[model samples]
Target chain A: MDKKIAMVDDDTDLLNIYKPVLEKAGYIIKTAFDSSEGLKLYKEFKPDVIFVDLSMEHFDSGFVLCHRIKSLPEAKKSKVIIMTSAGHETGIRFSTDTEEEKNWIKADDYLEKPISPRDLVQYLNEKIFKEK
Target chain B: MKIENGKILVVDDEKGMREGIRRILEIQGHKVDTTDSGALGIQKGIATEYDIYFIDLKMPDIEGTQVLREIKLMYPEAICVIVTAYASIDTAVETTRMGAYQYIPKPFEPDELQILVHRALERRWYILEARRLREEQAKHLLEVAHEQSRMRTIINALDDGILIINQEGQAVLFNPGFLKLLDINQEISIGEPVLEILPTALRDQIKEIFSGKGSVNAIKQEITIHPPAKLVVMANTTPVMGKKGELLGVVSVLRDISELKKIDIIRSQFVDMAAHELKSPLTAVQGYLELVVDKTLGDEPDLYDSYLKRSLDRTKSLVNLINDLLNITRLEAGKVRRELNRQNIKELIIDRLNFFKNDISERALKVNVDIDSNLCVDADRDDLLRLFTQIIANAVRYNKPNGQVNITGRQNTHYVKIDFQDTGLGIKKEEQDRLFEDFFRAKNEFTRNITGTGLGLTIAKKIVDAYAGKIKVESEYQKGSTFSVYLPFAKQNNFTIKNSP
Candidate 1:
């Protein structure tokens, strides 16, 4: 069976562009246009890997949705990746030391947008699809 | 009482006695007045401020003892002497009890009389000088107290928070500004330890300062107190050295710079957002062009054409974004020279309506114009034309099919107002506040398909503001939105034209 992945973002154009790029790399894809639908789909599909935009539906809603998934026992092994165009300026380093960094962005990995197709597939193979 | 010469009053039934007393006092450089009768003596005593009085017991109108008693009761400082011929031990004791200075026999000694007058004048001088010294001391004390109070008022009125600590690291003085800045409400007094009086973070700094480990100059920091509210402060701490070079205490002056820090953060965020915004379209253009050139569309004419079109569109949007950025920077930097002219607002609206005729007709938007032909606004012609073009274009672009756009103009004292009302995608109440902010656009289903650089309203607002005017919006989500601009009226015959440099 093909591994399942879900993407949540408010930007439809970017989502459309990303959908084929990820699916061409041989993975089943599901998408939600907003945070509410994203949460609904996350519970129903329970995808192995989730791609969430940082400010989807509302500011920092991606962090909120990721926290919900990570707190669930069933979703513990799922790879949650946070993507942002704003992170280009913020320089967000994923470290678990500080409480602020942990609470707001506790994800398995992070990606900055305008991500090349080649880099996206390689990052996915290494971070999510490696052990499986 | 006179210090150089004393004034004296003499009362006696014998004319010789009165003359003799007056001569003795006058020769001693004293001003002496005489009244033989006790009645006249009482009147003279009430009228004059005599320093000394000589009274006789044989007076017809009043006895010497009675006269002495009355004079003493009136002016307690008056020195009175009893010079009576009937003087005896009993008489002397009685007169002394009635407030007489001393007794003189019938054959009075000149030296004795002279000595008695001198003694009376000396006592008056001492009493007057003592009173003057006492008053001078009180005035000096009052002046010192007033000066200290004024100093205390000035210290408390300062805007910067000030904290003074003793050599033992105890808080000796804290101003109201200090308490307000720290948000501390408890009473702080002298000898309170720094840790007890200040926040823990500040206490650590103070401890470092006293121990000679902190910065010798001012230390600046941005701190968030109470979990959410952030404050930036510049604190200058210096040791107060005594005259003998002993360390007295530390003085800390705290100035709030949170507003300045906030502006810096906003400016940086604006720069980042602008860069990202510019990169987004460029990335899409690059990707599409690369796809077309690399023949990734599989040599299908339609696919190639579509990709090429998308690339061109993105390229166009990129150009528009750069233009908007340049416009905003030029506007903010005040580098754009304005050509002031008297512009007919009604004609301007008609011209814009004709300019956006295709978009308006495509959207089936009805145009309604209600304005006076002579309504004029003071503005830069090109800028005003651009301003109206943006507004009417937005009206046509954001309108629903078969929508109506009403352009109304009216003039009031000192100003002309032009309103653009569109039955289109209105903004949310919360989002409308930041609609004119740089790079802000309403993110919703309605605006998803609407093509905009999000800088139209920002530029429009900038233009209106440059004219020393105001722009405001009223909106109801999904119903309609109205954007109104108010501009100053130009005076007749004061028009001038120039190109933007």
Candidate 2:
């Protein structure tokens, strides 16, 4: 069975670019332009994996959505990934050493953007879907 | 003889001696008083400040030496002369030792008597004049000391730092204010070379002023103090010229302007960040389009479609950002029209809410409205509508799912207030003061994903200010936020809005 993945971002064009790239990697993908739409799609699709931009519809809205997904009993086994452009999106640096950082973002891994399609697929296969 | 010139007293047991002495002194231009007994002479001397006294050694009651002692003790400046008919060596030595000026025999010549009287009075005049001159000099010195103290007080009381340098670049005068402005210790004594005390940046300008170089007549410059304490100051240096218009030294005044410099730096930083923010989107758009042109995903419609959609969205966001910037510029420049009409407050808010119905339902957020429908205000309809839309839309967009948005409106005697309160990501206390400033968006983990141009609040504030209204925010980080707006009455009561701009 193909892995079910959902990606949420306000940049619809970026989503369009990411959607086919992820789809061609033998994963079924769903896309949303905002946090509200993303949450609705999450409930309907019950995706096995989630990819969200740190800034979408609102600053850190993706983090809030990720937290909500982790709190759900039905989605307990799902893998969540957070994306950002690092220096491009924000001026602050993040450290994963602190438990507070991991719990708040509720993501299993981070993907810095401007990434090629091949790198995105490889990162998912090795870090997320391989465990399943 | 005038008594004011010199008063003389003569005392002797023999009447001939007394009368002869008195006549000689009187003829020599002195007011002479004769006494037949030494006791009488002492009594007269006690009554006045006599300039000269002549006493006889062989007196019946008091001795001449005794009379001389009484007169000299009372008035030490009086010149005493002894006249004794005995003329013995013992009497002469005894009288001279007892404060007498000289000893003259009773059978003395007229010329000798006259010369003794003349010399005694002259010596008395010299002593009085010397005492008078000494007192005058003491008073003059006191007055000069008082004036110098007053001048020092005036210079030290000044707020601006002042320093007067000598021709050799030595600190001739360093006011207390100058030392404090530079944070230099008081132990740094005056007369030290200015190079040893002042920072190089300020010392250079002062040297330029003294050297009569570019704009040296009066030099004005901004300088930053060297580390350990970084301070900005506006230094004004002017040449202190002498009577011949020669450069004596330089007088420098320093005014602290670090606060203003800090504000200027912040404004410039925002401008740079704004430019970079605009360029970043362009760079991303260009990169994606180049990939499409390069055929990285050859013969694959799905792959190219995604890139093209992303490019289109980037263009759209870029347009939105430009529009936001234009609105702020126009509003700040006061180009927006303020055509006011009587507006039903609740109805306008409802109209704005209708535009956000989709967002509210999609988020499943509850909205509570407690507003008086009859409340009306004199305001421009479009401006009021936009104000409501932006504030309420922010409330919905930043709220958590299942959270609540509460709106309330009330009218008082002078103003009408509307509050949009939300259970959303709140602002930090430190960041709240700068929330309305242009390009100032909260940067944190929770605020990083927010989609905004950071110009919304700035424009909102400008619009509210045009109507002389006020907007304030209160929030607790991660708890919630409440934005309150107060719009004053357009005019007096019992009148409707009817102004056009």
- What lDDT does each candidate get? 0.77, 0.76
In the order shown, the candidates' DockQ scores are 0.20, 0.06
Tell me the spans in candidate 2 whose CA falls farther than 4 Å from its real position. Answer: A1-132, B1-160, B170-177, B184-195, B208-222, B226-228, B236-246, B300-309, B326-344, B350-374, B377-386, B395-408, B412-415, B421-450, B458-484, B488-501
Q: Estimate each model's TM-score.
A: 0.61, 0.47
Alpha carbon RMSD to native, model 2: 14.0
Q: Provide the clashing-pair count of each candidate structure.
A: 0, 10
Highest DockQ scorer: 1
B234-292 per-residue lDDT for model 2 (tens digits): 89988888787788888899988888887767655545555644653665576567557
Fnat of candidate 1: 0.11
Task: Give the DockQ-based CAPRI class for model 1.
Answer: incorrect
Error of 1 at A84 (Å): 1.5
**Chain A TM-score relative to the true structure, per candidate:** 0.83, 0.85
Most TM-score-accurate candidate? 1
Question: Which 10 residues in a row give candidate 1 chain B its minimum summed lDDT?
Answer: B492-501
**Residue B449, model 2: Cα distance from true site in angstroms:** 8.6
